[model samples]
Each structure stands twice: as structure tokens, then as C-alpha cells.
Target chain A: MSPQDNQSTSVAASTTPTASESASARKVSRTEVRGRVWKQLPLLLGLVVLWGVLWGQFSWLNILTGFLVAIAVTRVLYLPPADISGRLNLWYSLVFIAHFIADVTVASFTVAFQALNPRPIPTSSVIAVQLRTRSDFVMTLDAIAMSLVPGSIVVEVDRERAILYFHTFDTTTAAAVEAMRAKVLVVEARIVRAIGSKDDLARIYETEATR
Target chain B: MILDSILDILTGVFLLLGGFLSVAAGVGLIRFPDAIARLHATTKPQILGLAFILLAIALQERQVSTILLLIFLLIFQMITAPVSAHMIARAGYRGGIIAPRSLLVDELEQAIDAAPEFDDTERASE
Candidate 1:
């Protein structure tokens, strides 16, 4: 674990920072810059709301102070802001949430039962799935959601290619592996439908049409 | 009066379910064959178990702030859990700690094998 972790960090340290630096270095028009900052507004507001929630109060004074604090933190502890797709389909979001909850519940029990079963230990696999959307945000959300649902854990991410390699547990057959890969695509599609950019939506639809 | 008992019963059921899942998680850690398998064992059931427990807490307290805090905690857990799991799995895979015999297929290994190695000069630039 130690050697591998060191290698992982070395690889991560080498590859990731350069990409981020290049992104920040890229030239953008004034409106694009403004839009980027505008995209951060929700995050700032969410921070303010989180502060109020933490204090268990929403007083005007609290809100004002929270706003100031949010400003301070965002500046002092800077992180790249997410470019959220402004289009959020409420119906699809609800459906995604519903399906996610169901997956978590069902998968948890299945793993539990498998763990306690007397049968021979099932074999697992590491499979990579190419994502339709190149959006980092959607990829991350999909990874997080997939990880929590059980049976799959994200092992490595190829950011440039929009590929996620997942370690799938207790899948013994090629068919099962294929099934899991298909399931990952379905999950990604649901996420894209909910809040993906127009480009992402078109990419997903194009693939679906071709399929 | 009846509603109170029903809520109490619901709380008990959720708590019991959470406890069962936690126990299963513990059993899985010991029972699974390899590192990745153990990772799945611990992550999946523990999250659902924690969710159940949080649900029980929300049911019992029935306060706006408490529920809010509970949601925050769960969200924090959900966000962090996968990150740590990914880190561990990535390291373990790189470390060669996971036994190759245990896996039915290892697509990542093939990809890793096929990719060209980075030279020291390239790494030194960063």
C-alpha cells in the first residue's frame, strides 16, 4: 500500500496540477470571466446558508456576517469553481435521487447477504467505462454516487479521456462485468439528464440514438 | 397517542436495521478475500447503516436544526467516504497489495501496462 500510494501521489502530483494551471492560464472573453464568477455565486450563497445552518439561526445579522465570512473564505482558501449546467430538470433530478436511494438500499443488503453466505468467495474485476460527458463535475458526481451504491469502487480516473476505472466486487462472469459497465452508463445518463450542459445532453442523446 | 408509539416503533426498526448492517460490514471486512473486496465490504453497508441511524435520530428528535445537522453529517460522510476509498484502492492497486489471482478481470492493469512510462525529466518539470 505504501509503495503504491507513493506512486499514485507522484503520478497525481505530476499530471493534475499542470492541467489545472493550464485551465487557469487559458484566455477567456470578459463575459466568460464574468460567467465563471457568476457560477460561483451559488456556491458562495450555499456557504452562507451553511453558516446560518451551523449557527441554528437565520437572523439578518447572522446572514450579513455569514456573507462576509463566505467572501473571506472563498478568497483566502481559493478552489476552482464548478461550472454548473444551468439547466436542472427537476423531474430527472427527483428520478435520479429515487433510483440512487433504491440502489443503495438494495445493494447494501445484497452485499451483506453475500458476505454472510457460505458459498466460495466471488471474483471481482477492474473495468474502465468511457463517459459520454467530459464535464469534470458530472464525472465526480457519478463516481461518488457509484461508490456509495456498493459493488463498485472507483480505482483510477483518466481526466483527459473522461474514463473511470471501477473495481467491481463479486462479479464472476464476463456477462456480469458487462452488466456492471452498462449499469454505470445508465447511471451517468440519469445524471446528465438531470443537470448536464446542452453539449452533454446532445452527446448522450447521440450515443443513445446510435445504440 | 398512537402516532407517538408508531414513530417510536419506526425509530426502533431503523436503529435495529442500522445495527444489523454495521455488523455485516464488520463481518465482511474479515470474510472477504482481498483488499478491494474488503473495501467494498466496509464502504457499502456502513453508509446505508449510518443513513438508517441518522433517520432514526431525525425521527426521535423531530427538530428542524437537528435534522439539518444530521443531513449535513450524512452529506459530509457521503462526500468523504468515496474519496478515501478511492485513495486506498488506488494505492493498494499500485502497491500490488491486491492479489492478481483474486480478480476475474483486470482492465486497469492492461491499460497501465500498455501506457508508456513517464521519464524523470518530465516529472522534474512539475
Candidate 2:
């Protein structure tokens, strides 16, 4: 769903969009609904895997029951079908994962050191990064990755505009804020390359061309 | 025998690092000025610390079931921590617990003001 084009405008408005109800209330276009199971394959598989993991068993009995329970849960609770790009890039995915871990490691040390230092932090900033993709999955993953990278907390997301507002530490200057914004965009770019849809890739190109 | 000793030492190092990072988060929580800043302290190091400890656990046990559970735990933490962090930050900002003056830049406030739907940050400012 294009956050900017979302019909949730009539609902309560804030820097962040109100959480859509049960996720069921959100609109799903016909194009997004390729086929029932085809669209939901990932969700069902995730649930099954989650079930098996919870049980800590990979036995055949566990698989059968997990699949059954997954079907039941999906049937019982309506969730918005995630918009998947249907493309998987293993190399890019590995790159994202590796870099993400390294980021967490390095940034954690930096922030931890700052915390332990006697000197007080002067200021922080709330900066917005307009993401290239409006895909919910990509946006969610991007937000998660950025938040995990330390020094930044996702304060608000303007779902309608595909904008993410981050409250970050040590960004007292406009240039520092700009750097933070660029950092978030790079994270978004990494996500888009990993599993982003065709439209998302195209939008990234458009952004590059425009810049 | 030598590899076993090295692995044991590595596990010990991971555990020590994990503990140190967690302590750092605690120190950060006490030191940071406000809720948003404290959030960075609480979440950032805490997650990586947990990851380190979990890795230590996996290394020590080297059991399939143990490792799988750890993996699930890590995945869930990665997914959920950001969400809760976001919610806390959002509440702090909207409730105006996060002092407006402490912030060097607030692009969100302008956007909130620009929206046609709602009225007033007077309650927020107060």
C-alpha cells in the first residue's frame, strides 16, 4: 500500500499513522492478491516455522501439527497480506545481514562508550528520511534495521508520505542530521535491494537520477 | 584439545563482552537526560549484549535444539525491540515528556502542525 495514497487520512492524523485495525481493516488491492495461498505462503510458512521453533522440535509429527495449527491461526485471525516482491537475492540478503551485524557491533560500542563517559550529551535531533519504497514490508524492515543500528530511535513514521522520523543522539548540527538521514536512506537502499519489489527498485533509480 | 580450549576461551570472552555491554546500557539509562535519549541507551547495547550472551550459550551447549531456540529468541528480539522502542518514543514525544528545548531538530512537529485533521499542541506543550 502506498502510504501517501492510503485511505486512512480520514482517521486520526499524527506524525505517525494510527495502527490499522487487526491489520484486517487495511485495504489490499486486487493486484496484491495474486492467489489466496500464493500471497499468504510466506505468512503460513512463517507461522509453521514459528510453531515448530516454539516447540523446539523438527519432527514429522511437529511439522504436521504445526501446519494444521498455522492454518487454523490464519483462518481465525485476519492479517493484512504482506506485499512481497516475489524476488529473492541471496547475495544481497547476505550482504544486508552481514553489514547489519557489523553495524550493530560497532555502533553499540560507540554508544556504550558515550554512555559511560562523564561528559554529557549536548543534543539530539528528530530527522526525517523520505524512503524510496512505500512497500509496507520494506518500510517495516527498514525501520527495524535503523532502530537496531544504535544512536537512532524511530520516533514517528508518516505512513502516508513514506517518511520516517528518527530521534538520534549527538546530531546537534544540520549537517549531522543530514548525515543521519543519508545513513537511514542507505539502510533503506540495502533493504530494497534484498527483497524489494520491481517498483521499489525503479523508485530507487528515479531517486538517483533526480539527485 | 587445543581447539576445545580456544572455543572455551572465546565463549568466556563473549560472555564478558555481553555483561559489559549490558552494564553500559544500565549506566546510560541513569546518565541520559531524557526518555528518548535513554531509549538509545536501553535498547542499543542491550540487544547486542543479549546477542553476545546467546552466542555464548550456543557455543557452550552446541545442541541443535538449544541453538534453534536461541535463534528464535534473537529473531523475536530483533523484530520486537524496535516496535516497543518506537512506541515509547512516540508516547514521550506526543505527551511532551521529551522536552522541546532538548531537541536540536524536530521535523515531526511541523508535520504534526501541518495536518488538517487535529488541533493544538497546547496540551502537548504543557
Candidate 3:
């Protein structure tokens, strides 16, 4: 084994047990606690808005109740601090939404046509797509987007290689499989551009363009 | 008057198409051979059907509050549906309920064999 590898392993072995034990009972400095709450502010606001919508009233009374409910829920639920890069490109977000809407419409028609067709169902495949993005947010977004479209659903996610195993309908050829893989990468690029850090956005697009 | 009639007709079309797609999804669920195909039936059309229904509702009730609620319903459904499907697919895969013949690629099986975390779960199923 390499010297660096041995050193890292030793460090891991030494810290793991104590680190895990402290994870649950760890005390935060006041400044760190305040920082966490500040980071969660957007989430709290979003919950309040959701509460108002659920009640079908955006009136002052509803807003007040929603705020109280949101605070109560946040306090009870131990939510980790959000890792928001806070780099949002409005243009990219709009484009992504437009693309998503188009995909949804296309998917609806495709599935509907397949369901209503007189011919026998073609064989489907469980295809492995190796994704480029390793970020948890990107992977989750891709999974949700692909799964919601109907012709495919993510059966397994191998986080190590960032591969998604999809149960896909009517993928008969290697070319088709590659096309699906490309489409996912394209979607990831769009997502990274929309909300990811500027460096992430540039790197994804740059790498995708090269491919 | 003409505009109102046109809106009504559009609403009717949306609702009709939505209902048709939903029925098609139901048929797919029954006719599809295995677990994965059945999941495709459950998720795809249902969200669009719900969207169409919400559109119809929004058209009928032009109140801002009602529209907001409908929009929220759509957003929540879009978020929750895929998550539930993922969970079910994972369970079905781990439990070995999904047929081998039905699967074309078995990368996940290979992944589990390589990964240590799934060892206990995979063995327990056996």
C-alpha cells in the first residue's frame, strides 16, 4: 500500500468511532446554530407558502398560522443544513422548465400510444446509464425527472460510479441505449446550469460539449 | 360569449383526454407482465391526468386561492410520485420479487455484489 493510503486508513480508523458517537450528541456554537437557521430560512419560507396553499387561503390569518406551523415543524424535525450554492441563473431555469414541460407532453403521448396500440408489447430492457454528475441533488433531480416521464423508472442508483439502472420500455439497440444516456447527461447539464455553482455549470457544459 | 364557449370546449377536451389517458394507464397496469412495466403504468399517465383535472378545476374556478391550491397539488404529486416509485422498486429488487427474465440489464445485481452495504439485505432475502 502507498504511504498516503496507509496514513489515511490510520486516520480513518482512529477517528471513526469517536466521530460517530459525537455526531448525535454534538453541541453547536451559538454562531454555528444561527448560521444553520439562516441557511434554513428559505426552507421555512417555502413550507409557509405550502401551508397557505394547502389551506387554500393566502390571507393574513392563514399566513400567521402557516408561519407558526412551519416553525413548529422545523423545530420538531431535525433537518440538516442545506448545501445551496446560491448561484441561480434565471434564464437557464426558464429554459429547463420549458424543456421539462415539452418532455412531459411527449412522454404522455408516447406512453398513451403504447398502451392503446393493438400490437403486442415489445420487450423492455433494464439499462444501466453511467451518469456524470455525482452531486446528490443532481442525481435526485435526474431520477425524479426520468421516473416521472413514464417510459422509464430508476430501479437502482449506484452512487459510487454515479450510475442509474433504469427499467426502460422498448430499448432494443445499443444506439438507443446510448441515446438515453446522452439525454440524461443533457438534462444534468441543464440542471447544473440552472442552479449549480458557476464552476460546476462551466465544467458540466464544457465536458458535455467535448463528448 | 364566443370566448367563454371556446374556454369551455378547451376545458372539456382537457378533461376528456386526461380521463382517457388515465384509463389507458389502468389497462397497462393489468396487461403488463411484470413489476417494472406495472410501475410505468402507475406513474406516467396519472400525473398528467391529475394535471389535466387541475387545469379543468382552475378554469372553472377562477379564484386565485383555488388556483394556488390546485398548483400546489400538482407540485406535490410531481414530487411524491417518483419518490414512492423509487422506494417500491428498491424493495422489489432487494426482495428478488422482480423476475430475472423481465430484466435486460443486471448492473444492480453486480453493484450489490461489489458493495458491502447491501450484503446483509441481499443475504437476508435468500
Q: Pick the candidate with the highest TM-score.
A: 1
Residue-wise C-alpha lDDT for candidate 1, range B6-110, written one tens digit per residue: 999999999999999999999999999888899999988999999999999999999987888898899999998998998899888877888988888998878
- Candidate 2 ranges with C-alpha deviation above 4 Å: A1-34, B116-126
Model 1 error, position B29 (Å): 0.8
User: Could you tell me the lDDT of residue A81 within candidate 1?
Assistant: 65
Q: C-alpha displacement of A54 in model 2, angstroms?
A: 3.4
Residue-by-residue lDDT tens digits, candidate 1, A1-211: 2322323322133223334454764687899878877888888887888898899988999999999999899777666566588889999999999999999999999999888888877998999999999787898899889999899999888766788999999789999999999999999999999999999999999999999
Candidate 2 residue-wise lDDT, B38-89, digit = tens = 9999898999999999999998899887888899899989988987898888
Return the candidate ranking by TM-score, descending.
Answer: 1, 2, 3
True contacts kept of each: 0.80, 0.84, 0.59
Model 1 deviation from the true structure expressed as Cα RMSD, one decimal place: 3.7
Candidate 3: lDDT of B21?
81
**TM-score of chain A by itself in each prediction:** 0.86, 0.81, 0.80
Assess each model's interface with DockQ, reporting 2 decimals per model: 0.59, 0.58, 0.42
Q: Candidate 1: where is the Cα deviation over 4 Å?
A: A1-33, B118-126
lDDT string for model 3 (A52-121, tens) is: 8777668999889988999999777655454566677999899988999889888887877777787777
Cα lDDT of model 2 overall?
0.82
Per-residue C-alpha lDDT of model 3 across residues B1-126, encoded as one tens digit per residue = 997888899899989988988998888887777777778776888899889988988887888878877887888899889878877776676677778776555666676668776566435433
